[model samples]
Every structure is written in C-alpha cells, then in structure tokens.
Target: MAQSNPRKSGYSFAPSPSSLGAGLSVPVGRRSVLGGAVGLSAMAALTACGGGGGGSDVKEGTGAISFGSNQSDAVPKAAYKKMIDTFKKDSGSKVSINTVDHNTYQEQINSYLQGEPDDVFSWFAGYRMRFFADQGLAGDVSSVWDNIGDDFSEAFKASATATDGKQYFVPVSYYPWAVFYRKSVFADKGYDIPTTLDEYISLSKEMQKDGLTPIGLGDKDGWPAMGTFDILNMRINGYDFHTSLLAGEESWESDEVKDVFDTWAKQMPYHQKGGLGRDWQEMAQGLLQKKTGMAVFGMSISQQFQGAEGGEALEDLDFFKFPKINDEHGTDSIDAPTDGFMMSAKTENGGTAKDLLEFLGSAEAEQINTEADKSIVGPATNVDTSNYTALQKKAVELVGEAKHTAQFLDRDTRPDFASTVMIPSLQAFIKDPKDINNILKDIEAQKKAIFTA
Candidate 1:
C-alpha cells in the first residue's frame, strides 16, 4: 500500500482476541449487491458459541468491537483474516467478526442496522453509505478522517462522505471493472485486445470461429449483469446520463437506455448461454479454463484462481478498459467501487470502533490486504506497489487515470430498485433479450415508485 499513516486520529482502545479468523459463505440469492445481520446471525451465534475456533475474550472500550463482515469468498476472507490479525496484534483489541454471505448482507442491511449490529461493519461508499448516514444508522467518522485525511485522495474522501458532508466511511481498497481475459488464451489465439466497438465485435466473432465463447456472462445470483449494463450505458450514453439514470433523474424508458439494451441484445448471441444459472464466480472460471475469450468484470474475478492454482493463472490474467463505444465518453468512466468500513450508530464501543478505523486506514493494513489479494488496490495514497503483481500495477494505473469513477450501479442507486426491480428485470432480459422495451418500461415504473418513496 502507498498511503502514509499520519496522526492517530485521537482514538483509544485496548485489544481482545477473536476466534472466527476465516470468512465463510452461506450463499444467499443468485446475484447479490453486498452487507447484514440476518446473514451474520447464524455466524454470530457461532462466534458467540466459539464455533469458528475456541473462545473469545470480550472487553469494553478495550473490549472486542464486533466486526460485521461480508467477505464471503475465500480469497478476500483470508486476506481480511490476516488484516484483522494484524489489527489485533497492533491495537490489542479483540474483534468478533461476524462473517456473512455476500448477497445476504446487502439484502438485509436495513434490518441489520436497525437490529443489534456489530460495532463496525463492511460497507461501500456512494448512495449506499450516504443512505444509512441519512437514516442515522451509521456513525460519523469525521474525526477519524481528521487524522488520516491526507492518506486518501479527495475523490475517495468525497466518496466516503455522506450527503450531509460528514465522513461516514473509511475506504480501504477498490478494484476497477474491465474486460478481463487470460493472456494465455489471447496469445494462443493470436488475439489482440480490442480497442473499439467494431474491434470488440470482430474479436467476438473471431473467437466464435475459433470455437471459443467470446464473452463470459453469468447472471445467476443477479448483480453481475449490472456490471454489463453499467459499462454499456457509460460507453453509449456517457457517465453523467448513466449516473442520472441510476439516481432516477432520467427515465429508464429513454432512447439512451434503450440503446444500451439494444447493443447488449445484439451482443447476447456472443455471450455464454445459460447465464441465469451461473454466478460471477462460475463466469470467471470459464475465463480461467480458457473456455471463454473474455469476461467483462472486476479484478476480483481473480479470486477464483487463488489457493489451488496460485498466481500463475492469475499472472496470465490481464484486462483492457471496456472499449470506447462513443467518442463523447472515450473510456472516461469506470465502475470502481469503493469498499470500506463503517461504524453503526448504535455501537456502544465508539472508541474501539474509531481506533480500528485508524488501523484500517493505515498503509500497513492496506499492504496486508493488497499483498494477500492482489485483485484489489489499496486506496491509501502512499501504498507501496513493490510487491504488486503486474495486474495490480495495471489496475492502479487504470483507476487513477479514469475521468469519472462510479460506485457500481447498485451502490450508486436505490438498493430496493437495484435488488428488487433491476435484478429481476436484468435477469429477464438475459432470458429474453427481445422484450427489452417492456422490461425497461416496467423498470421506469418501478423506478418512479421507489425513488418517490
């Protein structure tokens, strides 16, 4: 990590040890948006009962800050575990990590916050964090940022700030969304990364001729499709319209949205079939296995290559920004979601929570995270890139060079609309790309109700 750790943010807490070191997945919906207590309830029970390891020695101000986590997949889980271990060792505070399935956390976040929740929890920036802060659910972290303020860029600081102009989140890491492919696959096929819409389409058709699935698409569990829509909309209509659309300021039934749907519909034939039955993990697997030429996704897809395969296959992984579809946009925008920690408004251990946020914002914590899982780049301005895999280096550059960074679609908009309306709607489009007209109309109707509500 490159970010410099500055002042201590004037928070104090003692350490307590946690037992649940590894993260686990319960597998919620087909595609999940992300956060929660419902998913963590079972895990919490286990943590309370010491099911993950032995027993926890809970303390107050110096006590264990219950950490609500949603890093369900193994790679991030392991990375988080190491990072948490470092925190415990450094701060001498115990963290009882209640790990939950990724999708379940997001689906039940409101209830989780309203219910008794962990003192500190995983969360994203944008409307997601702002919404909770607006509802008085998230604790203010303005003071925490006062000490670590220089560690992050202004853009990241803005993302972590709530609508009320207070910092509610401490960003740690983020990954850019792009067209990921195994370099070996491209090298073997003598394929060059596409730079434009025509080049991309031509490459897809060429891959088909070579008996390779051109694009890997998995809509199961649902939100993976949102990545597709986000990139396409930005590429076609530009970022402002896309962001406005997500905010429900623009009609979903407009020609701009229709054009994105139309483009995706035409490209559907080139996408892997049976998308509704596969998750993003499975789609990443296709790229790893060389069955598919490329997958439009975040670098986190490399999580699938960890453990058994090591970084060799991942070393073969590379990406190109989704090619420019409109000269107006010119690959200027990216859905590079900012992920970080937030404190619950109800946390009785505010001191300990802020202390933990202090450690989390440090370059040391980011170093642990990035080294363990190279898929993510530490957002800390001074992060060390010496140990970075080639892909990580490229990712840092890719994100830094972006003109506009978006918190993925779900994060940028209403959670209800994203999960309830858009998820199903996009899944339907994947099932029948022909009826996009009706699908968008239905979405606009739902958008009206949800945004108004």
Candidate 2:
C-alpha cells in the first residue's frame, strides 16, 4: 500500500484527530508508552558512544559494509542495485548485499537482527521501525538525518522518528492505497468512477452483469486483505478510531469494528473467488488481462503491468480514492505506508553504515530509485520529478490531498499481532464471512494478550 515521487507537492503526514473528526481526541498515550519503552536502550547507547555511530564498540568505516535487502522482485531488486552501484561509484565504498525473499525476510527479521545482521537493511517506518528500535536492534540514524533532513518534509521525518524523538529509519519512498483500474477498461465499458459507497456497489453490480469479476483480491500472502479492511475502517469509523484500534486502545469486539467486517462481508460476492489461493501479482495480472474490472490495491501493483510483454497495460493504469462510506469522514483518510532503510544496532562498521545512510537519504539517490521504479516516489522534497510518469504524479497528488494518512494495518499495529493474529483471522473471514463474531472475539483476546505483554 505505498508509490512515486512529488517535488513541491506539499506532501504532509497524518493529521490530528481534530482535523478528521470534530471533537474527537486522538489518543497517543499507548503509542507513546510503546515508543518510550523501545527508545530507552537505543538512546542510552547513543548517549554513551555519542552521535549516530551508536556505541563505543561500533567502529568507523573500513570502506566496506554488508547490506541485507528484501527487494527480491526483479524491478525493485534491479532498481536498488542501480542505486547501490551508483553509491559505490560515487563514494568509493564496497557494499556486499545479502538478498532474502521479501516475505521470509519479514517473518524472520527478529532473529535476523538478533543474529549478525547486515550493516544496513531495508525496513519500514512507523510501528515496525519503532518496535525493533525499542528492543535495541537498530542503530540511531539521527546524525545521518541531520545532513539529509533539509531534503525531506516534516511528515517524512516524523515517519522515520521513533517516539524517543530519535531517528531510526531513513525513508526513501511511499505510495497510497486506492481502487485501481485500467483507463481503457473504463472507457470501453463506459464505466464511471464511484464517489460514494452506493455508487461503488452499483458499479460492481454492473461489472458483474458484464461478466467480469468486480473486484480483484488475492490474499495468499495474508497481508493484502488488510488494505481493504483499512480503507473500510477509515471510511466508516474515521481515522482516529482506526488508529486507536490498531494501537490496542480500542476493543476489536466493539460494534464499530464489527461494522467494518460486516460491510466487507457484504462486498464479498463482488471480490474474486478463491482469493486465499491467489497472490497480489496474480491479481494484478488478472487486472492487466482485463479479466477483472477493478482492484483495490496500492500503486505498487503497477509493477505487474510494467512487466507485461506489450500493450498499454502500464500506460492504462489509473486509480481513484476509495469512495466515501460516511459523510462525516468523506473519503479523508488513506494508507500511505513509508518504506526505507535502517542500520542494524550491531553493525560492525557504524561509520560506513551511517555514511551509506547519508547517501541513501540524498536527493540524488531518490532520483535514481524513482527512475527505476515508477511505482514509488521519493521521500525527499528536493527530488527532481521532471521525469515522473503520469501515474506517479497522480499518486503524489492523491496522497497530498488526503487529510489523514495511515501506515497500513500491519505497519500501524504491533508486528506480533499483525503476523500471528490478524493475518490468519482475516484469512478466516475471507474463507467464511459468517464467522464475524468469532473473529472479533479472537482478535480482541489476542490483542489484549499481545498489547499487555
């Protein structure tokens, strides 16, 4: 759920609850406590050793550093390589990359960090970054931020900062989650973009009548469905409620949360069948082949069409904000997750690692990245977007116009709960929508245990 870059777009971060829901108090107490707990050791280490190098044992550069990357997909992998190769050429430093499968890397990150992690590794912003940083698994990159901070927006910087007010992650790019379709498909079918929930349902019904699956959904990887849940939750209950629920400050068993599930269940008939057996790439392929009428997906789904052998698959890609469900919320919130890099707490060459981070946070690096992967935009505000594709530009506009932004369900909540509880629980609902009460009860119980522990 995150894409392409916009320079001078005035791209902002999450808005306060006051801005989203009048008179609603956004609770940061729980999130603050979590951040405090996580930043303690990291801050202590930073104080003891001084600056971003982390600790006394952490050494200066040997001109060579290893990197762990989860960008196994060909497009992003090659894109990262182009950026890294340029870094090597520009800085005269040696980078050894240890690439892992994306899902496997995320599943094993805890152990990977506890063991001998690379000097720097690909990571995400928000709760996931703070979670590891709090456990003393990541290096303080504040020093790197000092040099590159001017290149980014305040929101982008906040995304990289833990509750400790210290920087642990360096964001490179982000994209928003929205309903995507092929312009050609809409034109050929004379379909209109839905601006309200009723209109959305009506359009789906029309697609069904035309012998096309109304929605493309694939959850074999378990995380994709969270996007649907996220947009629905925001549209129905508002952004404040969505964030509070993910923070474990709200009961999953509440009627509000149940309403989100109930609504999604009603739309199941419109979604592709057997989603549990399909992956996102397959879903994107179906969209590209025009077998499916529409898909609620992140801009990164463009990668699938970008790889197609021919036709205007990539060129025809377009999206609209998920239609409004509540007049009060009015399509105000979106999931625009930030993806970036973090230095390992145990990096052998702290100096070299920080040096690499400094380069990665530069406008030059972001330019190189966006040039390779049009699906993602750079976080740096100074990035030259002269070459941005039409799709990339619109993505930036969509995110910038939104009143509130979320980091997606998995990134917004505890990693433990997301992977262990929500993933399977959502899959269960997809398999059998009637099991709502049971799913909510199970989620609440697991959330309590996880959050309290």
Candidate 3:
C-alpha cells in the first residue's frame, strides 16, 4: 500500500468500536507466560502443510471435524499434528487440517472466518482476539473456559477474554521479544552484555567491525519490524505512553514518538542489508551461522536454530532484555505476546469445536504442544514444568521480572489499524529512513481517522 495523504484522499471515517482497551486485559506474570521445547527442522520444502485441502465436506453431526492451522513451520506443524493425532485416538474422532502460511493466514483472517473456516483455528490473544469477537467473527468459548478455568492463571484467562467479558480464545503458549544472540559468538568475540543505549550502540559497531551484521532483521512479512518499534517506543517513552500511543489516546507526532524513529534510524546501519526482502527465518539463520551478532526476536526464532544446518546451535542460544534507553523506564517493560486457538463462528459443528477447544486448554494438551515446539511454554498453570529446557526456564524468569508487559504491537492495538496502517508505515520507514517527517504526519492522520471511526 502506498503512503496516502489522508486529507487528499477525502475518505470518510467509518465508526468502529470506541473502547479498544488501553492495556492488556490482565497483567502477565512470570508463571503465566509460556515457552516450549526447542525443536529443529529445515525450512526448505516447508510449504503450506495441507494446501488446497478444504474442510467443507465434514458433516456437522459426525464425530469427524476440520481444523484451520497456521503452524506451518516444521516444529510447530508437527507438534500440532501430534496433538490432533492424540485427540483422534482418545476420542475416536477424525480431524482434517487445512494449513496455510502463517502470515497469509493472519492477513486473510477476516475472509477466512466469514467464508469456509474450519471448526477451530490457531489465533492469538489481546485486542486482536477481542476485535474479532466483537465483530462476531469468533465463537464464544466461555463455556469451554469454565471447565478448564482452574488449570490456568488469571492473567492467561484475561488474555483470552474479549471486551464483552466472554472468552473467545484458548491460549496455548507465549514467549517474550528480546535481543537474542549466540553465547558462543559473544564469548569468542569477548563481548559483554550492554545494559544501556550507548553501550548497545557501541557493541553493535564493534560487531560490524568484526564482520558480523550487528542486527539481523527480516521485515518482508511486515509484523517483524513492529517488534523493534514496540521495544524502542517502550524503552524511550515508557510503557504507559507506548500503550496510549498505540491505543490512539496519544499522538503519533509527539516528540516521544519521533525520538523512537530517530533512535531507530541511527541504529539502522547496523541492521542487515536487504532486510525488506528477507523473512525472519533467514535472519535467524544468520545468527546461527555466526553472520549476525544479535537479533531482536521472539522465542519462536528457536525453530530456525533447530534446522538441519544449525540444530546443535540451539543449545548456545540466549537473550537479554532490550537495553534501556530512558532511565525513567530503564528496561522495565517487554512484549510477551500470547499464542492460542479460537473457534470459528461459522463452524459446522460447535459441539466438536468446543470439545477440541476444551482439550486444547487442558494440561494434557499443553504438555503435548509445548514438548513439540522447543521455543515456547504452555500457559496452563498445572502443565508439567519438570522438563523445561534452560532456555524456556529463562524466558519465564525474564517475563516475570519485568515491571510491565505488552502483547506486541500488532496484537496490542486494533487489528485493522495494525494490518492497514502500521504494517505498511513501518515497512515504508524501513524502506526509506530519510522520510521520517512525512511518515509521522501520515501516521497521525491515519490514527485520527481510524480511532475516531
């Protein structure tokens, strides 16, 4: 999408839900955040798992059901299948999975739900879930929640609850966004962890001098860059301001907001070149290959490390909170987005869908899911943790120690605004850093229109 001048476009603002919540539904705690076992698989030949496979033929009254999944990556894809296979064996039911690319699934969710969506599907928590629930795109899962409520923490439950005080999502796992690096690389280079902005920049320069890309980022999918923006904004402006700004209660043109872009622009020279053309998996490969010093990413990056060429490198993976920029905020916040599943309102069999949703929320299901994906942890409170890897254990500690937690930029705000405005705007900024002034103006104009509408 081209950058549009809202004034010249003369587009009328369409009224939207006025009360998009300002923060997470419930505060995230250490025990409440999740991580799973890190597993490896090659990215090649990993296309849509079940492309062109339709679920329209499944009978509503039969025990068989269809599912739409975005777990197309090798580890998670296999993990989801394991869970479904278990579901089939235990219940004597059939499940047909229609898998799509993760990004495509998210971008086309509106049409998917309105069209021939499967009985249940993968989704996320936060306002993204609420937005769909309010629009009647998601089926109410409060009844499912009632049976499994005791198995989860209040924070996890709240994350799944929509604005109407009803649950529409069943959280499966969560992980924090942080600056990740290979411990071996840092040790070999005699590098120290930087806790302040100046040190962080200086360290990046040293890495560049050492023939390593200081920061490996891939924004081809658009949402990856939002993580960088979210962290920078929270670091420089404080968590409250970041939330307010994204919630549309604050202006995009504010000095605080501009400072974030300015800082990012200064840091962009250290980012991998051609980032706009690369996907996150490639960027993760850079870190595993020792071509990059660090990457600001979620725990899901582990999937890439477990690849055929880099599987053993997963053990050396470690991360630190994004360095503090403003002393007032002092690295007090982090984005720990929760991943989960939701029932489609258009399901042919609500009974089976709800039953599967209940199973998904159970400790037994969480254990199976977390065991398959090495990077995430289950959200269920009673899920076994005796087997958590060191990486997963650290992730829980990192999130627990934070003073504030966000659901990530795309999940924290209006989905329409994120998909339509922020994704393109952030990508535009990445494509051309020199155009900051115009970018801020365009964002402000769009925010006004979208928030009011």
Q: Which candidate do you rate higher for TM-score, 1 or 3?
A: 1
Residue pairs with backbone overlap in model 2: 2-175, 3-174, 3-175, 3-376, 3-377, 4-376, 4-377, 5-377, 38-134
TM-score of 1: 0.78
What is the Å distance of residue 139 in model 1 from its true position? 2.4
lDDT of 1 by residue, 1-453 (tens): 111010000121011011111112332331232335566555443323211111112222556678888776666677778888888888888888888865566555655665577888988877677767776768888888999999887768888888778898998888889999988888888999899999999999999999999999977777778889999999999888987898889999899999999999989999999999987677878888889999998777766765536658868888999999999889988888877898877666788888998889889889988776566789887889899988889988888778778888777876567767888899999999999999999999988887774
After superposition of all CA atoms, the RMSD between model 1 and the true structure is 10.2
lDDT of the candidates, in the order given: 0.77, 0.78, 0.76
Each candidate structure's TM-score, on Cα atoms with residue i matched to residue i, is 0.78, 0.79, 0.73
Question: Which model is ahead, 1 or 2, in terms of lDDT?
Answer: 2
Candidate 3 lDDT, tens digit per residue, 97-172?
A: 9888665566556546545678788877877787667766678888888899988766677778887798889988
Question: Candidate 2: lDDT over CA atoms?
Answer: 0.78
lDDT of 2 by residue, 1-453 (tens): 122111101122121100111111322232233345665434323323312223314556566899888777666677788878988898788998888866656655654665567899988887778767765668888989989999876666777888678999998888779999999889999999999998999999999999999999988877789899999999999989998899899999999999999999999999999999998888988999899999998887887787475846788999999999999999888888887899987666888898888988888888887887777887777778889988888887787777777888877887667777888999999999999999999999988887875
lDDT winner between 2 and 3, please give it: 2
Model 2 CA lDDT for position 430: 99
Q: For model 2, state the Cα shift of residue 229 in Å.
A: 0.5
